[model samples]
Target chain A: MTTRAKQFISADQLLEHWQGHRNLTRRVIEVFPDKELFEFSVQGMRPFSTMVVELISIAGPALKGIVEQQITEFSEEVFQPKTKEEILARWDAETEVINHYFNQISEEKFQETFNLFGQYEFPVYQNILYFIDNEIHHRAQAYTYLRSLGIVPPFFWERF
Target chain B: MTTRAKQFISADQLLEHWQGHRNLTRRVIEVFPDKELFEFSVQGMRPFSTMVVELISIAGPALKGIVEQQITEFSEEVFQPKTKEEILARWDAETEVINHYFNQISEEKFQETFNLFGQYEFPVYQNILYFIDNEIHHRAQAYTYLRSLGIVPPFFWERF
Candidate 1:
């Protein structure tokens, strides 16, 4: 594959991983009765629904700001995740936002130096990896919730 | 709570979210048979373990960079997550690294813009939110794997 194709593939892999995890998590949620969605937990864990909202809130602006190269001003937006339909909508919105950012990257840009908060230094590419890394972290928890529910999610091997 | 107390509480909340989710995901991995951990998937999903590795590799550095405003230099190091033992070691190490940076943050830093991959711009705090957001994304996938195995990993709402 061409180098650019390869880069796109990385993004494709990320998107697949991101969406794949969500797909499975959704199954866990769908199986729940609505009341249980907010209230149930296997062990002092957040309810599946609460976690679902957690995922919903992070995508659009959180990733959006990073790709857009703007500083994030954290807010209660995350704490107040919208309805399921809204989460889905924001999820879709984040995809477009990410695609816009991903396609916008020139090879040179990836190599450029950028300051994170004024403390640590990083290249643009490194920041991208951070984005992917964080996704995997939380997805892992959702996996636990699924297992606790006794519903098998998608395979971990098929992430790519 | 006073405003500063509230902000601190929120920050703690975010950190706790990461920790709880990470723990839940790690548990999912522990329950998996080595074969299934690496091989099971339904459709367009990964082995779940790979996702964990990537998450482990990225979490500390990502947060440290953002909190410290450091520049990221992407290398094989960014993607080459270590073995389980190594990851566990690094995970502990990052806790210290992340703590140092978190303590160092000036409130102003949250509002300052950073060039994330030089693609889009965002405040540092948004990057923090993204960190939590992305973690949940991948953790959800692990939930899928747990269900597939006919094991219930844990409840989601019981985060500390």
Candidate 2:
């Protein structure tokens, strides 16, 4: 793919897209009852809070790594939230961290390959897309968990 | 959002990104045993087959509506696939259909507002995105179902 020659998305639009999904995910986090958020899982899927840690850990760190041109080991251990409020607080703080680093990325840099968490080697944009994609994937689980508990999720289309 | 002034994603990349998700969903559909695919549910969530029908009915039809500039009522009733093979067949055909109409949309048109199925009015690109996003949403339920059934799902990152 001629990454340098072709631009499909702008830095701003990409960030907005990522953040919109993040916004919806925040709603998912908000709606979860305190107990279920930390403990609920379908069969063997991770609890929404565990999933939230995985989501919280990625984008900001990955974007920071991309901007710094450094490969760091991925860790969710640093954030072990005991409550829903703790998870949401970290989520908000991480949003700022994401915006700070995300804005630093040049469009051309998006095409450059980065070994994310020193594991998955992909173009920077793909890695960023993974961050967004992974969140959506996990949030989908939380939605099912919510539904099985008889709660309606915020609409998927209402990203903003 | 200066939709015309700034191009964030090219048509090809957007379509490819979408198809990758579809490919993953296809694999998810493939892994389910016939009965579980048709009958299993977590609480009262729709069965995987029903979810697949909702998926099968979108994208191709939505793209067709966008290309034709006609708002048609959305329906999954037209494709009540009784077997896994039928779902896969329709899925493959719809993929081709999606490609055919998706390529017809010029970049400028991505920003145009269209009332999808006379229900959700959104930018054409967002509508297309909804198709991909909704698939992921439903597929997550299928994943939970698979795990509940003691089956391992395909890796989420291996979209291709």
Candidate 3:
């Protein structure tokens, strides 16, 4: 027998929570020196810029797919920016895209399974959590890079 | 006016999600060579063992505080295990402790704000999320360490 799903958080709270993380990550991008943002990585991990691009590619695109009920192929090759300015511009633009699509999801839709990128078959909410989780995963790498550079990264708890 | 808070996920789901990350982290610990587990560092970051201790210090202790409704000072000095087996033993023991206290928390308790460690003041749910979030944060660092050592980390998605 299947158990009824209980809501753990509100959609508004989830959006705000995800956005708080985005804001913190944006601050991370801002703190990086222009050259280092694209070049600095410890332990053979991709540079912070590359990691940021992976995040940029996921949330807005995946949400759009979820809202539209379509499974589209995931790709990070959509943008090839030579500068941090270009990346930040896309980040701000994607924020709006995320907001637009996130509100379209009804609370009930969160429990429906969607095969994200034709691979990860999980509930809508779990997929959304994946997006946020993946960001935190990469941002931690940036934190190490920052500490190595002797630059203090933004506080992890100050998510607003 | 205070708005009604909606539930987005169940406490069981939250515990499962957190444990998934912990399982992946445990794999990382298991793959490490004994000496390197304690000494390896890239970019001046602390060794993975130290980070694991920090995580161990939080989840069980913090959850116990929340369940008991007591605010205690946060400290990582409680455990000073000198071996990987010691750390793993403590990890397994703490898992039970986490499950014990986690079930004691009522749904309404998730909405109440508590001063975590006499430091972080947030709703019970947010505090719990922080515990999970903090684990992923440190575990990501361990992933990098593993990669640098030519040991591939456990698949991040394979939480179970």
- TM agreement with the true structure for every prediction: 0.47, 0.93, 0.94
TM-score of chain B of 3: 0.94
Cα-based lDDT at residue A82, candidate 3: 82
Ranking by TM-score: 3, 2, 1
What ranking of all candidate models by DockQ puts the best one first?
Answer: 3, 2, 1
Candidate 3: RMSD over Cα atoms? 2.6
Candidate 3 residue lDDT tens string, A1-160? 3444444567787888888889989999989999999998866579999999999989999999999989999999998778999989999999899999998887678878999989889998889988999999999878888887889889888777
Better of 1 and 3 by TM-score: 3
lDDT of 3 by residue, B41-152 (tens): 8766789999999999999999999999999999998898899999999999999999999989987788789999999899988888888888888888777777778887
lDDT of 1 at A45: 50
What are the candidates' C-alpha RMSDs? 15.5, 2.6, 2.6
Q: What is the Cα-based TM-score of model 3? A: 0.94
Q: For residues A118-157, what per-residue lDDT tens digits would candidate 1 score against the true structure?
A: 3335565555544444445454555555555555655543
Which stretches of candidate 1 lie above 4 Å from their native place?
A1-160, B1-9, B73-83, B117-120
The CA lDDT at A50 in model 1 is 64
Deviation (Å) of B44 in candidate 3: 4.1
- Evaluate model 1: give its lDDT: 0.54
Where does model 2 exceed 4 Å of error? A1-8, B1-7
Tell me how many clashing residue pairs each candidate has.
Answer: 79, 6, 9
